[model samples]
Target: MSGEQLNEVRKVIWLTGASSGIGRSLALGLAAEGHQVIASARSDVELAVLETLSSNITALPCDITDASGLSFLRARLSHLSSHLDQIILCAGNCEYLDFPEPDWDMVTRVMEVNYFGAVNCVKTALPLLRQSAAERPHIVAVASMVTDAPFPRAEAYGASKAAMRYFFDCLRLDLRSEHIDVSVVNPGFVDTPLTQKNNFPMPFLLSAEDASRRIIENLESRPKNYSFPKRLLCLLAVSKILPALWQKIVLNGADGKARQDVLNEKVGE
Candidate 1:
């Protein structure tokens, strides 16, 4: 369907991670476009701020890791007038593997938030999404472009996003007969509170608002995958297609030393 046609049909959207960053921008943007947007996040204050920004938005604060909390969120959704037309699973956490021994605990923590948190939201939102009368019920996940290539310190974060991408892709196949569309958003370095902690340079870094606008524009097509900005995506693609060259040129000993410095700084902090 065309973008205009899709926009004409105002959707009831459930957006997680709505406290800040891309999620916050998306909540406001969708509300401005006349969609009923249900915003979820652990920060009640932030969600409240989002609600004040737009009349079309409803604040629903709950931690994705808490199963009982999710049940409460589900109950709250039941009170809405219409079923969810789309679910954007944007709740995620990122953690890098530092020096010494590989921190399996850190890996699990990242997975818990990025992978399992999204799964928990999906468990609650799928029923509501199924209730939509629209030709296609959409599921949009915020995975990372880092998953396209292995980065030195991103062992946990990259793997979790990669797992999410795989899970959503498999889900798309399963939901095809039901006309449920799953779109995985692979964002490059977006300038959010999360990425602000990074000590290294971030090429093609986009503001949260720009990221949200791109995501909203692309979701109209409901493509299987959405990646940006073009420059970063192309860089990662090249790295994947030619690993040996990337290892020698893109990631040399200097890169390893820089990552070590980051780890040391984190430890000191």
Candidate 2:
């Protein structure tokens, strides 16, 4: 659909992970645009604050990983509004694997929140989206651009997002027959609570508000896949083309030492 057409419709959108970061900013942005937003997150306190900020937003606090809770959420959604026109599934988690006996359980933990959680949300939202009075209902999943290029210690985070991305891609095809549009959003480094913990550098880092604005604006076009920060995209593309060199450059430490060299330094100390 054209931007003009997108502007014409005020949608009922359920935005998950509305407690903080991109989800929080995006919820406000969407609400500001006059959309009836059912804001969701695991934190009741945060959701309450979000609701107080704008009448356009309603707080629905629930853990996305809880299947029983999602059913209850569907009931709450029905009570709040007749149908859902769109759903922006932004709920995710990240955990880096520490090498030299990495925490294998972290893989399950990350996948549970990022991948399986998304799958559960889609199942819960599909019925509501089908009831949409709008001509076409949309599903947008907020994935990470880490899938474009591998990063050290990001085994769990990147793998989970990559799985989510592929799931959405397949869903896009299957849902086409039903006319439910699916969009996978892959964002580069953004200033969020999750990223603040990283000890390494994050190039092209954008504020959550800026990222939200870009996401909300681009969703107007309903592109199947949206990835941004063009410089990072180009870099990842280069990585894809020349993997060995990419690894050499990226795995090199902040002080121009290779990862092995850094490890050796630590051992010597």
Candidate 3:
């Protein structure tokens, strides 16, 4: 189906983290659907390139984590349009804390970028979203599926996302009376510049384009919480119900026992 078929009305959308990864692909997809996309990211050069891809896209580069620097963003948006119909909060960072004298600051750093950065975006964009001509404006945030289960070395990343999850959930309740809809999307592994650096295996990973397509399609319904890749969700669910089993599996892999077991099988062969 065409984008027009998927999206009924064109919108003025503010999308963060549009320089790369899932955000970049999502911006392109939304722009192609005839929405006025204001793409924001820290990289000026890449945002420039993204703008060149479509006439509907306007590159407005800014760091979401910089509270003081967000003045520039607010000014730019005011100059661009009277109100924003939608805002997609996709900017985030991850830091895994390894055992044995890990840098404890990684938790604060991850929270600043992932959780507080989202807070900053929402605080700045709330008034504009309320001023939208659309009857019920939308706020969509890209969280993570990792929040459903614990993982080794994911202390910082998981906690930050968990906080984000709760924050959005409560925000959804608070905004409902005002007729503003909020959605928290928890996506599984996707093949992106960020995930490419991950050392462990990523099962049932999706390409950025595919992930973007799904997000656009699903957000139309505006479910309160959306998580993808059912297989991964099931694994995380098991981690909740049978935590000991999950721990056994995770510990085996983390301690290299799984690898040694494979080697033993190879030797027998």
Candidate 4:
């Protein structure tokens, strides 16, 4: 048997942000592999289309930020399956803090989706995840590599992802005794609708398909954290070892035009 098949046990997976980008690709990939996928998104129409693509996928539209509405979401989810063997918290959003008169509200907005939304999913799924028959159920979140280095105008997006990274890290420790595993996936720039509007150059930009494939392949190992592509991580490493040099790169020139271009360009992160 193939390693992929050997690892496959036909898990019931709940995936958020299923309407587009990485979430859409992951839904298709997991469903193609014969796993049952309960895909959620606020875009009910898009979720409907995704459901038609595979018998293995069931559309469960929801607003992850809706704290009060989660009881309804959970009830709907319970109606779909007895338990969730795994959950991929892929639902996210990005908003930049542009120069001068930046909208400070973007910080709260970004946190609502990328951080609180993820936590909400975990809150709703814990009971179901606990009921899974798998030896160790998995909880996964798709954060961003932007947290590795500070970027101008990326204050909101970066802070939200950094918060997400830490939350999952702590959750991993708490869940260890229950044999439930948690993993945080931090991907560098990927070509997606979210990044399509980015005007700056994205080094090592991978297509959504390529990014999804890498995520699927690596997730089987259930590492506490996974960041990619390797080259991008290496590039960001300079920010840590050589803070002065990093500042020179980001704060160069009176206008700091280069750094501005980078943040607005990568709002998707």
lDDT of 2 by residue, 1-269 (tens): 22233334489898999999999999999989999888988899999999899878888888988877778877777777767899999998988998799999999999998999999899888898998888889999999999999888899999999999999999999999999999999999999998988777576789999999999999999999999987668777757888886787578866534654533342343
Error (Å) of candidate 2 at residue 187 is 0.3
Q: Write the per-residue lDDT of candidate 1 for residues 1-269, one digit (tens) a residue.
A: 12233334479888999998888888988989998888999899999888888877888788898866777778787776347899999988988888777787999899988999999989999888888878999999999999888787888999999999999999999999989999999999999989998876576679999999999999999999999987777666656787875565445456645544433343343
Worst 10-residue lDDT window for candidate 1 reads: 1-10
lDDT winner between candidates 1 and 4: 4
Model 4 per-residue lDDT tens digits across residues 26-100 = 999999988888899999999999988987888989999999998888888888877889999999998777879
Worst 10 residues of 3 by lDDT: 1-10
Sorted by lDDT (best first), the order is 4, 2, 3, 1
Q: Write one digit per residue (lDDT tens) for candidate 3, span 21-105.
A: 9999999999999998889989999999998999888888888889997667787776776788899999888778878989999
Q: Which candidate tops lDDT?
A: 4
Q: Name the regions of candidate 4 deviating beyond 4 angstroms.
A: 1-9, 253-269
lDDT of each: 0.84, 0.87, 0.86, 0.88
Give residue 43's error in model 4 in angstroms: 0.5
TM-score of each: 0.88, 0.90, 0.91, 0.91
- Which of candidates 2 and 3 reaches a greater lDDT? 2
For each candidate in turn, give its C-alpha RMSD to the true structure in angstroms. 6.5, 6.3, 5.2, 5.4
Q: Looking at candidate 4, what is the lDDT of residue 262? A: 52
